[model samples]
Target chain A: MPKASAKKSAKPVEELSYEEALTELEGLVASLEDEQNPLEDSMRLFERGQALVAHCSALLESAQLKVQKLSGESLIPFEEESE
Target chain B: MQPTLFSSIHLTVSQLTLHIRKQLENDPTLQDVWVEGEISNLSRPASGHVYFTLKDKNASLRCMMWKPDAARLRVNLQDGMAIEAHGRITVYEPQGTYQLAVNLIQPKGEGALYQEFLRLKAMLESEGLFAPERKRPIHQLPNKIGIVTSQTGAALRDMLNTLRRRLPLAQVILAPSPVQGVEAPPALVKGIQLLNYQLPDVIIIARGGGSIEDLWAFNDERVVRAVAESKAPVICGVGHETDFTLCDFAADLRAPTPTAAAELATPITILDLSSDLLSARTRLTSLTLNLLAEQKAVISSFISRLKYISPERRIQSAYQHLDELSRRAFSALTHGIQIQISNVNGISKRLLSLNPEGILSRGYAIITRKDDHMVVSKVSQAFGKMKVRVSDGEFEVNRGLDTAAVIE
Candidate 1:
């Protein structure tokens, strides 16, 4: 049934770390390569792997240094010295 | 005792010195003594041994520290520095002199601090705070990093620059604190606590190289305990490679410099991570495509296999066999009818050949006496009126007339 994979893909892709996304993508590749899964399950895994690859690429493209200070309870912007 | 015969058999210098060496080496009070004195005539020879004389106003003692022990000394030795030395007293038999083989030494002013450091180290070690199993592995890719250092110090800048250059994806949370001074210990402890509240993946506590007193805050009991108890793994980079503090021992990992800590905090750089992501995507694509190809092949093979055993084909074959059987039956029925017709024709021909009517039509006749209806084969037997049979008629006077004509 489609119910098993529904829970797996429910988690938002934006919330995953780059490492997490890469790990999941690698796992999907391994399972798909195993050739034991049914056609329906293999398709589901491929879809998930595609999403993870996209998420990882997006994370790589969106690289900006974020330095902040812990002031009281909040994290304020950190002013870095000019090189 | 006879005083004239050289009293006690004049002892050799080597033999006397050996006796003195044994006496001094065996003395419980002299061995393992901690002597306090001002260092004098300190000379580090080419052999790496420190040959120094320690003297007070009353007397002086010759001290020799081996290369290994001398290397372990944290303080730079100089003449006229008041120090406390610990070692066993032993005699130099060649020179017939006694000296202390010093293994441990501490400057007089800093000696008490060193004693306290040792005591805390031993206590924390017993508590398993510095256990290898207690050390947590640093995250390969830290999303959020917490740093505790002086904002004005070069260490913070170095670490920031290194992190920004290597991996800018990580968000750094700086908890500025005085790294050294009387106010530093409590501030450092508070800074670590504050970072722990944020729950960053990793924490870096660092400062530039300095004297022991200058970096004493890291050695403070409160700071070391804070590091040991940190929720997130702590990386201490408080001083240069040679300089160490108690916090370094308590931290999950030790780095020689602040920059090194920043580097260590992110083991995988952005470039490597990006390449890895691309490779994984490629593998995922290729693997899925290969699976699809295999599935397609399986489906096609299934279709071909189904064609061989399909019921529709079997039904068609059954229809062909039924048609062949009907054709054979029809041919058999026609052949049997032909044979029956031939038999009937043969029987009718035989009956026709034996018919007496055919002989009558061919001008042959049969006669019999009228009295008993007997057949007359000879002419004398047919004198009277007799019956005669012909092919088309029957007559009574015909035989008599025929016979008379024959007689005439």
Candidate 2:
């Protein structure tokens, strides 16, 4: 009964901070690059890595916007002026 | 008193300078004097010294704020921050003029100037100039880079060399302009607008380090506005690490120096890109190999199972089944034959039992005349010329001489 209850109540892992997620993603990348882990473990890591990547991407997107606002400008293509 | 002319002359250079300094220090009018004027020709030297001219409508006096006093002032000293300085007027013999040696300086309240900066900032911000959503992302690998700096300065050269070294494929377009003085602001603004029209992937606004006065053009409202309004992502690399300008804030990115700007603008080398591609290819190949290995393992397992089942045993089982079928077939055939034979024997026995001859052998016979096979039983028939078959043998029948004829 205890085992069944544990299985029924199991929740997904908590969301990580941007730095944590990025670190995890880097670790996943390194592990994948090494190619030494078992297939099942690798698949698990890949799933986690996908989540981390999404988190990092969101963080970067927001950070870029904040920087742009602070800088008070639109960062766009350069245009030239005529003499 | 008339006899000693040297004594009458009386004062050495140091003594005269000290006397003047002490007198000015004690003078009540010169001390704590409030002078309202336009500031001009402000100079901050390497030795942490400040020299500027404070002028009224008619005349101007040279003022000096040594490093310690200037450093103590809270507000930034600009060419036009109308300020009141508490100082004494003293004569320097070499200059032959009495100047203000300032001890304390404070702003006269930057009401109009500060308000203008705020107003412009708010106007641009309300127009979505400062909106994060409007800012464009810098390209990871820009094919073309535009630089807005003086053509003669080290800034342009640094950026060019960096681009060449890091990203050889990148084409650099130099939008040369003056980087200092009054002309710099207009030139920079025009350069930015021009670059916007040209539409380069990325632009760098850069300048070497200088005094605040020298770098003032970058702080101009026009230059800041232009930078903020640029269509291209502008990177401001104006001066050393310690220096900052309005352009830096308005720019999409800021680098510590021209070299750092180059580094930020283009960091990836072709070698790195190729190495990344190669690594990706290797990863794909490894994944494929692993998948193939798993498939091979499954196939080998199936083969082993097939081998373990034993083909010879399967054939032997088939042979045993065939033998069992043959035995059943033979037994069925024998049983059918026996049934048929028994049926035939029963029919023959019934036929033998039914036969009249068989009855005769049982001590019974059908009596008949010798000439015919008809059965006769009455004596009258026996009197007529009848031959009869008895159980023992055949007999001929004879008519008796009638006593009845003698009697008639």
Residue runs of model 1 more than 4 Å from their true location after superposition: A1-20, A23-48, A61-65, A77-83, B1-23, B44-49, B57-59, B62-73, B87-103, B109-111, B121-140, B151-168, B207-215, B235-279, B302-408
Model 1: reference contacts kept, as a fraction: 0.81
Best candidate per TM-score, number?
Answer: 1
Q: TM-score of model 2's chain A, to 2 decimals?
A: 0.53
Per-prediction DockQ, in order? 0.59, 0.02
What is the C-alpha lDDT profile of model 1 across B53-130, one tens digit per residue?
999999999999999999998778899998889998998988878899999987775777877889988998898888
lDDT for B246 in candidate 1 is 89
What TM-score does prediction 1 earn?
0.61
Q: Top lDDT: which candidate number?
A: 1
The superposed Cα distance between candidate 2 and the true structure at residue B200, in angstroms, equals 2.9
